[model samples]
Target: MHLIITDAWLARSRAIHLSGTRLLLVGVLASVFLMLMTVSVYHWLVVAGAGEGGGRLGRFVLNDEMAQRERFMRENLDAMARKVGEMQARLLQLDSLGERVSGLAGVSAIKAPPPAGQGGALIASRSLTVQELDALLRELNIAAEQRSDWMTMVESRLLDEKIRKSMVPTQLPTATGVLGSPFGWRIDPLTGRSALHTGMDFQAAQGEAIVAAAGGVVVTQEYHAEYGQMLEIDHGNGLVSRYAHASRVWVKKGDLVRRGQKIAEVGTTGRSTGPHLHFEVLVQGVPQNPEKFLVAGRDLPNTRSVATKSP
Candidate 1:
């Protein structure tokens, strides 16, 4: 590079010369000065303006976005907490219901352990975390399911027991009567010889109604050589009841009958010597003492040992 200087009054001129290295150094210095000025102006515009609230626009926008996100999260947590509380209340109701049903079913219910006591000074109250709420919900669900299953089992057991009791011969066959000839060994009325009497005789008026001892299907309804005008009911489990010396038969073979239903009238149709109902209970064709079953739920007088001349 070269620069020329002229003096007007002295009429003299001077020339100055520069090398490549010096010219390059001058260019670098000018670039550095421009960069410094640019940096100073930017600092005055941004940093100084922030102190006067004009530069706070970006900060305000960022804070608003963060606040919205926090609000959404808090709302969801509150909803979850409320749900957990509802589930807990429902579980308590279920527990109470189960206990009542268990009592009606005549069974003991398995109880859960009581919760631990909780008490503290009210220092602070904080919202539950997602993890804590989820745990509570899971526990309540399991408890509810277990209680439901237990109640179902109890119901099934109760139903089965009821059916079994209905099939047993526990009802008296006659409405009004006194025990005439008791079951067991006795003298035959006609032959005057020792014999084994297989049934109990109930002394009632002629045309008195005779009901069934239990619920069953009538299997035999015909006249017999010894037990004339007889009707046999076949209960389940190979148990049967026979009513002998009936005056009139109301049910026939294959007809279903319920306990305490009228089926015949009392009379001496066969080898009986008087109008009396001869009721007999049998298991697999083996005769059982009718007194054992008839005595239940009744306030009948004790059978007298005095022998009577009857079938």
Candidate 2:
């Protein structure tokens, strides 16, 4: 490559020569300097624009994205809160039900021990995190399950108690009868001697209805020399009741009978002077006072000997 220089004031011209390698080096340097100028102008324009509209535009976009995330999080938290509230309401209902069941079962309500005392000055209350809310829900669920199990056990106990009470002899044997000879030591009408009467005598007309005192299975339905045409009912728990001196038997052995059900007709079929019904309540084959079971609203004394047996 060649370049020409002219000096106008001196009116002189000169010629210079360059090699190909030097020309290539000059081209590279010129290109590099243009690139440097371009980069400097770009940096100046960016820095100046940052204080104007460009900075606000960038921040607005970032803020909008953050708001979307916050809204999503709030929706999720609200849903969880509603669920927790519902669970708490259900737990309260369960507590109330437990109290009612305890009353029905005739048992005192079992209460949890009081919590340890804790108090502090109101400083600040912060929103719960997701982890905390989840933990609370789990605790509520566990409490509900425990309450359900407790209610089931209470129901079972109540059922058992109801069935047990049904087996107790609380009903009267005869609806229309007058009390005659009481259950204790008395003069034997036939022997004319002092003897223990194991049962109470109910004076009634012949063919009067004689009902069972309790619900049980008939265990004995046959004739005895002393207690003729007798019927015995086993009222569970080693308790039994005997209806003796009946004219006619309406139930047989192994027959299930309900309380107050007619099982015989009163008569003087046994060694009795007149038409009467002999009612006896025996505990494990030993005689107990029939008044102790038949008489209402009174707690009678246990005056009869425990070793005494019905002859």
Candidate 3:
């Protein structure tokens, strides 16, 4: 090696020179380093998973890791956006399912039923975590239970309506019948004195077919001295209607019969009188006005009778 004092400066800063094989070796080494730097810049721009773009080698050296980090951050943001979309879809599905359950339960509105756990509606509305979702499920279960109870009530009401409609007589026991004696006070039949008639009497031709007033189980069928042949039916709901002065009994005890079913034949069997049926309405063993109930269908006119009839 050689050194030449070309400028008056520090010794370390003095000019140096090389020649022959040494100078040629330095030139070759410098060429190889430039080639390696060019290849590295191309690899970083195209083959390092970073998008290819035209940039200077100097810029590539300063932003090597930065390119990879930018791509990673972009992917993370896309994943986050997808997650948000999926969450919104799940929320919409939950809302649709809730509306269906409400309709099945016959509720016009969808509101979470109150439950013991958690504070109140505030907790459900603000519910976001797993524990909050569990609380919401509990509230929904409570609402379903209440709907079950309400359905039971509706069934009971429906049953009562059916029973009432059945118990109300659809027609008079006799076809060509007239109200001979109404329910309540009147004169005695054999005693010839004032008495309480507990039933309404329908006068008709002897040997006429008499039908049951309602659908129920036949409770009593027997021959009697004062009422002749008597038939009684016990409808459910604390109701029992009686038919007296029958010539023949068609239904025996414990026999089920529908309304308007033939139950007896009307005739003068015991007491001296024309054929008549003594119809009574006893609710919980207490006598009620039979005429009021009978007029619903029979439209029986008001009649005054100085007589006491049996049921």
Candidate 4:
């Protein structure tokens, strides 16, 4: 690049030549000066509010934007507060359900904590800031999660125990009958001598239906010398029930029977004075007190040994 300058100020023409490097330097300096002037003018305009409707419009716009931001923040805080309140209510409901389940399963009931103290001097309160509300929400969320997990475990255990109890034989064999003899020492009807009766007897009409005490599989169905037509049921968990002196047997060996299902008919087919059903409960091949399981199932009080005569 080249540049030429001519001056005719005193009747004499003068010429000057510039190199490419010098010309480039001058152009760069001019550009820098223009940039600085532009920056200074912009700064002055903003400070003096010269282009924003005499400064009132600029201040109004800024204030409006700030107000909008504050409103949005307040709305978010209110929503969070409502969510926390709902969680607290749900936690209380879970606690109540847990208490009822514990009582039904015979577990030790846990007392609910006492109500929090609320007595204090009444005073004006300020709105909570965002940071404070956030901290409170986090704490409440953790507590709720722990309680939910605990309640779920308790509910599962209660359900499992209830199912297991249903499969055990604890109910009476005869639907309606009077207790003929207790399960302890008794006089044999045929021999007329003191004998240890291993089973409890129920007096019912001949051919009356005899139901199973619990859900189980029939293990034996045959005639016996002492207990004519007898049927044995093998309940799971080493428990079994025997029904003897049946006039007729409705179930065969290996047949599945549910609780309260008719399995035989009461009669005096064996050594007995009258029509009756001999019901016995055995645990692990050993005879156990049937009355114990009966009382446990019915949740009845342990009183004196007495007969229950059905009306």
Candidate 5:
């Protein structure tokens, strides 16, 4: 390479010759200077796009990209907000269902742990961050799991209670009868004196089938001097039923009997005045009004009514 330098004050033009190492050094320096100029231009363009100097092409590209990013963020946030709203609505529905179940099951009161109280001044709302969304999702998941467990427990308890109630003695003892003598104070037919009637008398003809009111085991099936051929069923939970003054007994002691099963025939045996069934319900060792059980049975739409039949 050859280089020439000239100046107005110089007496004559100066010439310099470069070769090998010197030429290589000058080429490296020129390369470095060009690199520095390129870096400076790039930095200036970046600053113009980011700052108030928005006159360059870089500013337009950057604005378009930023607008797209903002739209994407807003759309995502709106979608998440809709999902959160749906979850909240579901939670409200679960609460209402829980309350109804509790009332029907006679749970008295459902006890839930009190939520921790929080107090804060209302502030300007902002977009939710990922961390906030994660926290909300975790809370909703925990609540849903808790509600599911509660519903399962309520269903189990309600089922058990329904089954147990069905086993209790609360049905008419005969399918064909009329109330002859009600429970409570009545003049004795034999003695002709005021006496406390321990049971209700169902007036029916002889040879009429008598059925068990509820499911139980026959605890006693024997003849009594005052009760005639009497039968007693031991329903569980300290409840029992006695069918007295029967013409004949069909079930034996220790025999399991289901509700509405034919157990005996109606007759006036022992100290009765006419053919009737003396039905009694006992709780523990005390006698309860048998009519109450029959009335309760009547409230059920499926209860079988007593009808007159031809012998």
Candidate 6:
């Protein structure tokens, strides 16, 4: 084949030719030489223009792709920054609301320590570090916890106050009953001397119903020499109320009674001059002006007006 190709090329002109093996070797050497030339060209280009790529694709497509990716990243970063700012504002709002609620709940002032990290501004506004933000969150949590605690305290106090408010005999038990002697220092009806009056005397017709002023457990339902056919109720909050001079007692010890419940009938018994109810409000076992707590001012409404509340 080489002799035939050489003779054919010699006939045509100076068409050099190789045998099969030499053709293979020359092809390999030519491939190696082309690879080296390519590498040298690449290095020359890269060294001459450092930032510009060696044999890079045209700038149009690659630059457009890079610009779009950068724009997308910038937009995403901007949105994330906005969200962070909104969350920070929300945290501030929560702090304000917590303060207001705490005030209404009668919570004491919190002794918060000073913040660290200079806590200086972000664009003229005090910026909080991650640590400072966490600290603020902790303080808010503590404030919220204290608010709940204060609400619980208020609830307990309100319960007791409501009980006390209800317990005092604020109105006449029987519609027919009217007060004869008021509570205070008064001339004794029998002795005619300035004596401390312990309770109010509600004069009424005999057999008329005597109603309880509040819901409570009956502590005493027995006859007494001074207050015959007496009924005493233990309303919680260190309060006790008595209904005396009852003709017939309907409640006994430990019996639960509600406001306006008929516990007895009016009677002229013991020290009473006629058919009447002797009502008393005792605080810590000592009698006080029942009128001060009953039929009083805005602290409590009239017994007829059940709208007044306490805490």
lDDT (0-100) at residue 125 of candidate 1? 88
Per-residue lDDT of model 4, residues 1-311, tens digit only: 53445465655554567688888898999999999998776555545677766466656766899999999988888887777778778777877886787777666544556879887887886567888888878877777777767667777777887657666777677766478787888778778899889888888899999988778899999999888899999988889999999999999999999877899999988777788998889988888878777666665222223258554
lDDT of each: 0.83, 0.81, 0.70, 0.79, 0.82, 0.71
RMSD of every candidate to native, in Å, equals 17.6, 17.2, 19.4, 11.5, 13.8, 13.3
TM-score head-to-head 4 vs 6, winner:
4
User: Model 5 clash pairs?
Assistant: 175-306
Where does model 2 exceed 4 Å of error?
A: 1-110, 113-134, 296-311
TM-score each candidate.
Answer: 0.61, 0.59, 0.46, 0.62, 0.56, 0.48
Please give me the total number of clashing residue pairs in predicted model 6: 0
Sort every candidate by lDDT, greatest first.
1, 5, 2, 4, 6, 3
Report clash pairs, candidate 6: none
Model 3 misplacement above 4 A: 1-160, 168-171, 296-311
Task: Measure candidate 3: CA RMSD.
Answer: 19.4
lDDT digits (tens) for residues 37-116 of candidate 6: 98877555544443456425335445788999977866765565566667657655655665665565555534445557
Question: Which ten residues in a row are the worst by lDDT in model 5?
Answer: 302-311
TM-score for candidate 3: 0.46
TM-score of 1: 0.61
Q: Cα deviation in Å at residue 75, candidate 3? A: 37
Tell me how candidate 4 scores on lDDT. 0.79
Candidate 1 per-residue lDDT, tens place, 1-311, comes to 79889999999999888799988999999999999998876565555544555457545666799999988998999998998898788878877887887887888886989989999899988988878888887898888788888988998988987666666677777765477888999999999999999999888889999988888999999999889999999998999999999999999999999877899999999998999999999999999998777655254222223233445
Lowest-scoring 10 consecutive residues by lDDT in candidate 2? 297-306
RMSD of 1: 17.6
Candidate with more favorable, higher lDDT: 5 or 6: 5
What TM-score would you give candidate 2 relative to the actual structure?
A: 0.59
Candidate 5 regions with alpha-carbon error over 4 angstroms = 1-88, 108-141, 191-194, 248-250, 296-311
